[model samples]
Target chain A: MNRLQNLFANKKSNLLSIYFTAGYPELNTTLDIAEALEQAGADFLEIGFPYSDPVADGPTIQQSSEKALENGMTLNVLFEQLQQLRERVNIPVLLMGYINPIVQYGIERFCKKAAEVGVDGVIVPDLPIYEYEKLYADTFKQNNLSNIFLVTPNTSEERIRKIDGLSNSFIYLLSSSSITGSTLNVSTSIEDYYKRIKGMELNNPTIIGFGISNNASYTKACEYANGAIVGSAFVKHLAMDDYLKNIPEFINNIRPRS
Target chain B: MKYGVDEHGYYGDFGGAYIPEMLYPNIEALRAQYLKVLNDDDFKAEFDQLLKDYVGRPSPLYHAKRYSEKYGANIFFKREDLNHTGSHKINNAIGQILLAERLGKKRIIAETGAGQHGVATATVCALKGLECVVYMGEIDMARQAPNVARMKMLGATVVPATSGSKTLKDATNEALRDWIGNPEDTHYIIGSAVGPYPYPEMVAKFQSIISFEAKKQLLEQTGSELPQYVLACVGGGSNAIGMFYNFLDDESVKLIAVEAAGKGVETGHSAATTSLGKEGVLHGTRTILMQTEDGQVVEPYSISAGLDYPGIGPQHAHLFKVNRAEYVSATDDEALNAGLLACQLEGIIPAIESAHALAHLEKMAFKPGDNVVICLSGRGDKDLDTYIKHFGY
Candidate 1:
């Protein structure tokens, strides 16, 4: 079992995952941020490699991606920075981005390099299930990388079952049918959708994401799934002064330590 | 091999719905319903009626006498510029608006480069009494001020896309985000033959009336349905695809697509996509796109706002790969000069985008009796500012 499977096997609930853009704010801060997140009790983390067109992201993530790109973050540079990942960060790391860059980098080379760099999984939102299954499934499998699939409120139950079958780590449940950074409303309909997915009792765990901004939302999300992920909110936190020093506080704010 | 999209939404190895899960239901809904609605008797009658009465269809195929004499060929101009909104963009807008109504979508959203598509979408929305929103790049709004004004006058909200080169690509990205946010109520009327599966195929079908009319008219005028050469300028390739649609099966007719080479193809500033691009995904469809070595989309430059896009439609990409059509480019100066030549010779001022195709005539050595047809995709009225500044008029 890989880091992702082992983590999911050991921990059943309240598994907090954090997401941030690599090379954002500065160039050499990628590993630094990862170490800080790991130290601050993030169960797993998704390091976003910037793409010029991030259509699925909201303003906060967009700005961070732009800043990351401006800081000269490329997959080549990202991989070089991640060379020492296993030394300091023990939590499962997933590389998240659009599919074009991965295609440009050569899918085989990218997956092999991700494995070499101690990356556990990947999350490509725009990479459709059809494409992943047909083209890159074997490459990911060969690398022991969990290719995480997202489930939205709009996703059909049949498609969700298909996604669950393909997935080995966990399913990413979008808080709503919206882009990143939206506030989790937890409306009656949303609750029903959550209930429907929960009742399925799929083989994989489900981690709610895309708007678990605070303790209240996080708590509400954990009520329906295994855990919650904070992306745009954490990226927003990273923009604050002395962000590295305050990583622990940020984690505490989401789920205060007993 | 067929030049049409397959059951899987691919035109050869290109084209697919590579959108996020947020857009799956919307795209899937459109995918399932588009063909059924398009072929329905009621939908066909309504679409045909709108094309005839509202959009002024059967836009004439005029034989350009002076252009024929100058270019040493029987040159004809397919007059898409005479459409109601001053461009062929209205055809797709009307078709999509009718489709949106049938699908129960309450609002319409679109992205524009030159604002021709924006104005067209807004015009159709007003006709249907639906809310309209157009995302135009901040720079495009400044360059194409008249079109922006026209969209506003047509009762559409114009939102400026202020990210990543601030051009058509960014506007498209912004429009997509808007669609993701309001998936149920909003129907995105993607202006060009770009975007995911059904969009590229759908836009091409709506605009196919160009070739459909041209073929009938050409046969009547020249006693031959097939022209020796057919030319159109390509950005996201909607107009070019439409112009090439009916004639694609006629293997004898030579198809030529012109792209914008801002300064020159070798120069860093150019939108000559097939010339400089690599195979990749952009705007949700797998196609050729101008990008850096690291896969960042390169900002494409062109004097014509309509052609200032970094990629072409997936059909165009497939056609390029299969060698079914000739892809060429003309620089800004060449297009500008061609625009003037058309004004003086043919008594018609073509849109700068169309002028790119016209400019290529100077480079080709045609036989005296070779019949050539060019798609004059839009009028030059929106480009008067650029024309005046270039000529110092």
Candidate 2:
């Protein structure tokens, strides 16, 4: 079984997931960040591979991607950095990025590399469900790597069911039909949409992402889904001067107080 | 031959909405409402009226007698240059603005290369009283200062994209990012028959009026509604697609798409998409684009900023693949000379992009009385500096 499946099986609710850009802040900071995030009690970590164009990202994440590229981050460098990652961090790690850079890197090679690096899954927002089904699903399945699909409020029940069928790890329930990093208030419509998805009882689990900032939003999101993944907000902390020391504090702020 | 967009939004193998999930709702809403809104009687009436009154449509299809005498073929110029914003870009702009209004969108965002699309979009937004934001590459804004001023004068905020090559592709990336961020209450009026699904089909249908009017005007001027050959320059291929849409069914008509070969096709500065391109997704659609082995988009070059784009529209890619249209290219020197010849012989100065199609005429062995229609897609007013620089005024 995949590490993602094991993690989800063990944790039923409020599973905290944190997303931070790989090669961000510094070129060699990914391992440190991952170790720090694991120590901070994050259940899962989404390591972003920066691309020149990230359509789904907002200013904060986009800036991180730019900085990562300027810092001479590439697929080879990232893969090399992750060579001994499993030795330090045991939590499930998923690589999140746009499809173009991966496509450039060769999809098969990317999947193989992810598996070799102990990555459990990937979140490519731009790769449509149809594309993955036709071209990459077999490779992912063969490599024992899961690929997460995102759903918006506008996704029809039929498409949602289809996406749920395709997704192995979880369906990323976007809080709203907007990009990441926006200050979002969970409106009644959002709550209603979440309820609708929960009612569907999809085959795979669900995790909410996008516009999830701070403890309140994260807690509110957990009421409706398996858990929540905080990206920009967590990434914002990583950009701070004392990110290594601050990671645990930030995670504790989002996670329930022990 | 089925040439229209399929239900899946594909033009054979080329088109599909490959946007991020964040943009799914916006594109989905657009896909759902575009056809219904287009078919609405009121929508048709207003679109037609705007084309007639504001855009000065039913633009004359003039017989270039001097050009015909010189080239040994009866050439007709579909005067898209006579439109209000000085190109066929205005046709789609007016259509999209009206559609955006009908969709209850409060703000409009667009990306431009040479700034003709920006000017056209800004003009429509000004007329409709919509808040407009236009993303343009820093380099393009500098090169096309006049059109940039025109966009600003029409109350559109022109944001410079400083990333990447600082060209059309980068500007489009910035605009897509903006759209993703502000998905609600903002409609992206893509300037060409490119990007995702509904955009390529929508812009093509809107600009189809160019050929729609040309067919009637050609029948009135000459006895045949179908010309032997129809030629237009391809950048993102909006003007060419607009000129070719109506004639796709006519198997007898030979369609020629001329791409910009900046220095030359082999000089690494050309924008000849079909000649030196591969199938890939760029700006949301799977199209033929100049790309590296690593799939990083190659920066294309041309004297005409409008033709400096690295990719062609997905529909154009489909057409080229299936051999429905012949794709050719012309160099900068050749195009400048052709622009000069058109000015001297036809009393009309064409935009440098349009001159590429005119330059292709020099290579063809046209038979006597061969009825050829060339889409004079834009006027040279905005390209005056480039023309002056080349010809020394």
Candidate 3:
């Protein structure tokens, strides 16, 4: 069975996916955080590859990523961390980043290492669906890494259906108008969009991302998709000095349908 | 012909849909609707009528006899600057504004580089009686004070994008956020062919009338339609695409796309696409964009506000791939000198945007027997501030 079908087949309510930049608290600490989250009741984890200027990201993630970059993070180091963390973690891990480093690292090599390191999917914001299929889609499929794609509110119905049909399995549904960490209350946008898209009747299930934080936003996101992914807020939570100790409490705070 | 970004919207090796989930419905809506309107005969009739009456189509193909005689080269300038609102931006704006009306969108938004497209969008919104908002860079709003006032005068609100480098890219981001919020009532009229699928293709079709006109005018004047070289400046590369569209299949024609090498390529102050950019996704579609190592958008520099971009249209990259068109760059000093010389020699003040094309004449040899037509994209009156700032006599 596909990941989404398996994830939703059992009626365990909507699963919550937490995202935090790897090695964010300090260098060589990614494994501690991953183990903490997995044990603390997280269903999925997203690992961010720090870029110099993340245009789509808001302040919190920008800060964590900058700190990660300053701590001397590179693809080689990220791969090393992932290789180490896979030995310990059991939840499905996804790698999220921009396109430059992967292209520089060579896409096929990146996918091969990702599959070896227990990565289930990959999300590169700058890789267009058409280019993804033409360039990296086959390589990712070859390595058994699902290439997850995003669909914003501005996407037309025809395009949504096209991309939904083209996507390997699941879709990354963005919950807000702006980037992550934006304080914009997008409740109306969310409500209106859910209705608009429910009509398209796409077969692929979705997981919401961006602007999802705390109990309320997470609960609201779960109303539409099979799950919701939190990046900036969780990343900020993990930036704390005692994040490992607080991981169980953090997961408890964001657990859906609590 | 790489045939990338074809009717299907794939730019050969680049250009495709890479968007967030929230935007999926909107993309699908436009994708389904774009083909209907773009192909419909009634829609074509209305679009063509507006092109003729509202935008003043068949814009003059003037022979620059005096300038040609002085340079000893046959010169012709496609007078897109003569269009209503004094630029080629109206061609696309009119088509899109009409499309927005068809979509029943009540509010219109646009992103501007040199404020030309902003002005054009605001003008069309006023005529259509829809609420209009323009997003311009803070730096651009200050430099383009007159266009700002023109937008305000036309009953449109001007919002300055202060984030990032406060340039065209930032302004586009602001406009995009606004669209996401009010997708039902709002329509984003992107000024360039740099956005995601269908947009680059749609904008190119509207602007392609330039090449169609030149083909007819060149045939009438020289008893032949083909030119040795058809040239235009590359600021998001709209005008060059317009001039190159009808001639794409004409193998005898030589197309030259010139970009602003605002100081020089080495100094990191150039918008010269093929010279410095790599294939990547930017502003939505995969195209050649100048970016830093970490995939972060870097600050782009240019003396001319219009050409101050880090990327070019995907089709230009496709042109480079197939070797049908040659790309060139003009430094800041070279373009300004060319802008000044055109005014003094031909009694014509070319927009700084067009001056990049003029600089190409100095670099490339235009034989006396070779036919050369350059698109005078817009008028220089909008660039008086730039001229005075450089040459205060």
Candidate 4:
């Protein structure tokens, strides 16, 4: 089984997944961030493969992606950086990004290379669910990579159920129908949306993401799913001058103290 | 050939909502309500009135006697340049602004290459009393300064996109980012028949009035509802798609889409999408785009900023794939000469983008009575600087 499947099987609730762009702040910082997140008690890690045009990302993540690209990040470079990651980081690691770079790298080649380097799963937000099922699902499964699908409040019940049935790990529950980094308010509408998804009793566990920044929002997100993933907020923390010292503090502030 | 978008939002094997989850609700909302709003009597009434009064539509389909003599054909020009905002762009802009109002959106965001769409969008937003922002390439803003000033004068904020060749593609990227950031209140008025689903289809529908009007006028003048061929220049292919939509099922009326070949199709500096592109997704739709082996989008070049986009609309991709539309290319020199010829022959200064369509006339073998309709998609006032520089006028 994949590390993500194993991680989900072992953990029941509040399983925090931390997302950080692979080469942001500086190049060759990939392994350090991954190892630090695992050591700091993150249940899983999503290493962003930066692309030039990230339509889904808001200002903070977009800026970091731009910097990461400027810092000479590429699929080949990222794969090389993550080669020894398994030696130091025991937690599950996923590569999250747009599909264009992966296609440019060759999808099967990317999946094969990702597996060779110990990547646990992949998250390409723009890859439609139908296209994945028709063209990429078997390739991902053959390479032992779990392809995580995202569900928003606007997703139909039928589509969400389809995604859940195919997912061997967890579904990424987008907190609201907006991009990453915006403030998430757990208003009655959001609470009601959470309850509706929770009531579905999907086979795969859920992990809420998008708009998850601090402990309050993270806690509220975990109330509806298995855990929560923080992206733009954590990316903001990484861009700081003192990120090396603050990575642990940032992780600790979002996840409960172990 | 099959016409219109399929249930999956595809045009043949192209087009779909390949957007991130954050945009799902917005796209879904649009897909669900677009047809309903378009078909609503009130919406139709308002849109029709705006096109007739504000945009001055049923723009003349004038018989070009001098041009017909030069090209050996019965040539007609669908004068989209006569529209109030000076291009066919106003048609889509008016439709989208009305839709945004119906959707309760208070702000409008758009992207522009030559700035025609930006000016039109700003005009509508001003008319509707909505906040407007337009993203334009820094390079395009410099070349198309008059349009930039016009947009600003009409109360639109013009954001210059400075990244990645600083052109139309980059401007579109900046606009997409802005929409992602302000998803709740901002309605992205994509100026072309590109982007994710419902947009390509929606923009085409709004622009379809071009061919619709042409068919009626053709029947009245020539006693035939269809011309022998219809030609228009393709960028993201809004005007071309709009010009071709009403003629798709009419097998007798051949469609020709002209692409900007820059210096030449083989010169490695061109916007000839069908020739240089492969199947890929860019700006949310699956279509043919110029890209490297690793799938990074290649920056395309054309003297006409409006014809410099790297990809055609997805429907055009499908039409090209099925051979329903003949995809041809015209180089910068050829288009410049055609623009000049039109000036001398018809006393009309065609936009350099539209001159691509006019350039295709040089290659065709037309009988004396063969009727041809070319969509004059825009005016040349914005391209006056380019013309002056190129010809040393």
Candidate 5:
């Protein structure tokens, strides 16, 4: 099993995954951030390779992506930085970005390179399931890389089932139908939506993401799923002074260590 | 061999809904209901009525005698500029508004480049008494100030997209994010023929009225339904696809699409997408886009705001790939000069976007009796400041 599968199997509840742009704040800070996240208690992490046009992201992540690209972060540069991933970071790593960069890098070549770098899975939001199944499924399978799929409140039950069938790792559950950075508002309808998904009893574990900011939101999300991921919030924290030194404080603020 | 989109929303290998799961329900709902509503008898009647009475349908197919004399061909202009909003964008806006109404959507959102589509969408929303929001690039709002004012006067909220390049592409991204946030109550009226599934096809069908009318008018005027050639300027290729829709299968008729070459195609400041672009996904559709080798979208340039887009519609990409239609480009100087020539010769001032297509007439070798039709997509009223400044008037 890959790192993602193994992590989900070992950790049953209250898992925390932190996401940050690979080359944000500075060029050579990618591995440094990853090592810090692992040391600070992130169960897994998503390393976002910046795309010029990230439609799914809000202002915080969007600005980070822009900053990352301006710092000259290309897929080749990202890969070269990730060459030390296995040596420095032990937790699961997933490369998240739009599909164009992967397509330009060549899908099979990308999967192989990602696997070689100890990357466990991928999360390309724009890569449709139809195209993935028809074209790139085999390459991902051969590379032993889990292609994570996202399910939103708006996703139909049948489509969610299909995503579940195709998924080997945890399914990403967006807190609400929104871009990243919005606060997770746990209204009656949202609670019902979460309950509805939990009732389905799918094969794969579910990890709530998008708007999982602060302790309260994270705790509420953990009640419904296996874990919750902090993306925009963590990326926002990276903008603070001496962020690398305060990684433990950030992690503790979300889920205090016993 | 077919030029039309397949049931899977593809034209050959291009075009599919490549959006994130956040947009799946909205796109899926549109995909499921667009055709059924479009073909319904009541929907058709209302759409036809709006075209006829509200927006002015069957916009004239004027025989441009002076243009014919200059180009050595029987030149005709499909005067889409005479529509209520001074552009062909109103056609699709009206059609989509009706569809949105039927789908129980109360809010309308759109993205605009030149403000023509924004004006059109705002106009339709006013007619339907629905809430309207338009995302325009910060730079575009400054350049196309009059259109921004017009949209505001029409009771639509104009939000400035302040991200990457601050142009149409950014506006589109902002609109998409808005749609993702408010998926249920809002319907995004994508201005061009570029987006995820159903949008490209739906916009093409609505704007197909251009060719549908032109063909009937051509037969009456020239005693022949088929023209020797048809030309239209392509931004996201909505108007061009519409102008080419009925003639796509007419093998004898040649089709030409013009793109904006800001300085020149080779000068690194151009929106000549098919000329300088590679195959990739942009704005949720698998199409050709100008991009860096590492696959980041490159900013495109054009003097005309409408044509300052980084990519074309998927149908245009397919047509370019298969050589079904010829794609050419005109620089800003050429298009500006052509705009002046049209005003002096034909007594019509064309939008700079349309002037790109008109400018190509100077490069073509046509027979004396060859009948040619050009889609004059919009009026130059919104571009008066640019024209004045360029000419030092």
Candidate 6:
């Protein structure tokens, strides 16, 4: 069964999802990172497409994105890497980016190519669910791709379920009100949010993202629900290159001690 | 009186599209059809009629006796204050909506800062019975509640943008995002004269009608076609462009643009373009804008909410660089005083947007018989809320 379909069934193990920008430390390292992540025990990996304006990201991810852009990443290059990376990695590789670049890239053509490239899903941070349904819902279903939506703490109960219903896979729960890598800890706020959604009868499962920096932070997130997403910290490690090969040890330090 | 845009869509050096490659096609499409549709005999006749009957134009040019005597100079106010929707925003809104209808665009979207543009857009959309959606910043939505309520009552959806800095620039970004998503059916009703190519040109043309009327009024009053000096405020530089369009080539006339010096130009809180901004690409074209070394857009601050932009219109940029126009900056306190002075002397409330222009008259020597015409852009009723908040009035 699909990861989302499994949630609807009896088994409900907390899923571990990881988000990392494509072409971060060096160009053409996307497939290697994807293979490494899946082996290191990640359930799903969101591949961020670098954008000029990323309003919701924290400082860590923002720096990572800038580095990715500096290394000269483009949509065409990302697509090429994804096309090749998807063949080697079995886990669902979700493409995440802002709407403007994709809109300029041609939505229908992008979806058609995603189908041919082995992308399981796509998450656009800025596109509202209502607009997606009215405009591009068919394109996603046609491309055999799941459209992921996000639910924030400020999101109402009814709105959460509505978005969850629209979202095919688990909804991406934005950890805090601000961007990623913000100094403020999202623990209490995130915990309260997890508890609130736990009772709301969500249409799909939820994965926590943004602000999962260290092992203590990651474990605190896992305790609340599904495996927490580690974006900025991993991107930070990758940016330093020498420490990237040591990611397996980092995962061991964060993963279940067993 | 002539009320048409100039050949190059400039009021001398105050208007032009300074955009980049990404926006070129959209601008080109609009440019190709704008003049043809705006000039169609039927379009002009209907537009002129609406301006007269609905908006109540040819609005009286009232002489501010007390203001003139106090300042030791004559001041004639072009009362756009009596227009139906309360500001010069409606002038462009009415024209653009008419243009959109002519272009066969099904829906219209607008971005507003101080809410004047959105209200005007919503008012026109309601009149035309077309679907309208206005994107505004969450902060603006909160601060400009009355306008938001007005928009909703007019049957336009107000989308509160939560992304970026919650202000006009962010709202514009959101609206642009929407346009990129639904390009086929949407006509972006740009609030001011900044955007990718044709928008800056098209909006300036629609706004040009202001100067066209001012010219006739000034000529009749002074018995001359050219005044010694003409002045207006700059945000996206629309009102100034409108007032300057016909007078661009009138070499005898001096064009002066007043910019917002929120605190001061040296302080970060100023929106004074020529004083601080460098030549850079913003909105659609290359213009003077405040930016970082890496080309990131900086948030602008100003006491006048309308003038809080890091960039100026491309036409203004060219004018500043070519030294064709005289540019001045007014402090926030200066604008407030001018707002009070106009109200006290003329008994006509002007919008804060227009008061920035009024503030500059104090800084210059209006030599006897200089024949200066200052545009009284809009009424102050909508800004009463802001006035009370700012002064505890």
Between candidates 3 and 5, the one scoring higher on lDDT is: 5
How much does candidate 3 score in TM-score? Answer: 0.87
Q: For residues B291-333, what per-residue lDDT tens digits would candidate 1 score against the true structure? A: 9878899999999999988999999999999999999999999
Deviating ranges (above 4 Å) for candidate 4: A25-27, A80-88, A153-159, A184-201, A213-224, A237-257, B162-166, B181-184
The TM-scores, one per candidate, come to 0.99, 0.92, 0.87, 0.92, 0.99, 0.64
The runs of at least 3 residues in candidate 2 whose Cα sits more than 4 Å from the true structure, single-residue gaps closed, are A80-88, A156-158, A187-201, A240-246, A249-257, B162-165, B181-184
Alpha-carbon deviation at A152 in model 1, angstroms: 0.7
Tens-digit per-residue lDDT, B95-178, candidate 2 = 999999999999999999999999999999999999999999999888888888888899999999987778898899889888
lDDT of each: 0.95, 0.90, 0.80, 0.90, 0.95, 0.74
Distance from true position, residue B302, model 5, in Å? Answer: 0.6
- The first chain of model 1 has a TM-score of 0.99
Give the per-residue Cα lDDT of candidate 5 at A170. 93
Query: Which parts of model 1 have CA positions greater than 4 angstroms off?
Result: none
Q: What is the lDDT of residue B205 in candidate 4?
A: 94
- From the highest TM-score down, the ranking of the candidates is 1, 5, 2, 4, 3, 6
Task: Give the DockQ-based CAPRI class for model 6.
Answer: incorrect
**Which stretches of candidate 6 lie above 4 Å from their native place?**
A1-258, B1-25
lDDT of 5 by residue, A119-230 (tens): 9999999988988998899999999999999999888899999999999999999999899999889999999999999999999999999998889999999999999999
- Chain B only: TM-score of model 6: 0.93
Q: Residue B288 error for model 5, in Å? A: 0.4
**Model 4: what TM-score for its first chain?**
0.98
The candidates' DockQ values read 0.89, 0.51, 0.35, 0.51, 0.91, 0.03
Residue by residue across B1-393, what tens digits does model 6's lDDT show?
A: 132335544434333443211233345568888889988999899889988998988776666778777766667777776788887778889999998898788899999887889999999999999999999989888887998999999999999976656788778766775664455577889978787556777677888888888888877887776788788889888888888888987878888999998888888888888888766545544577775433445677886677887788877777777776888989888888889888777776788878988988888887776677787777777778767777798
For model 5, state the Cα shift of residue A121 in Å. 0.1
**Per-prediction tally of clashes:** 0, 0, 32, 1, 0, 9
* lDDT by residue for model 4 (A1-258), tens: 989999889898998998988889898988988888888889999999887667777778878887887798888888988889888888999999988777668789999999998998999999987678877999999999999998888788988988888888889998877767888988998999999999999999999998899999989988889999999888888867888777889988997696
- Tens-digit lDDT string for candidate 4 (B1-393): 367899889998999888886677778888999899999999999999999999998999999999988888889999999999899999999999999999999999999998999999999999999999999999999988988999999999999997667888889988887876677898999999999999999999999999999999999999998899999999999999999999999988899999999999989999999999988888999899998765667889999899899898999999999999999999999999999999999999999999999999999998778999999999998889889999999
Quote the positional error of residue B92 for candidate 5 in Å.
0.6
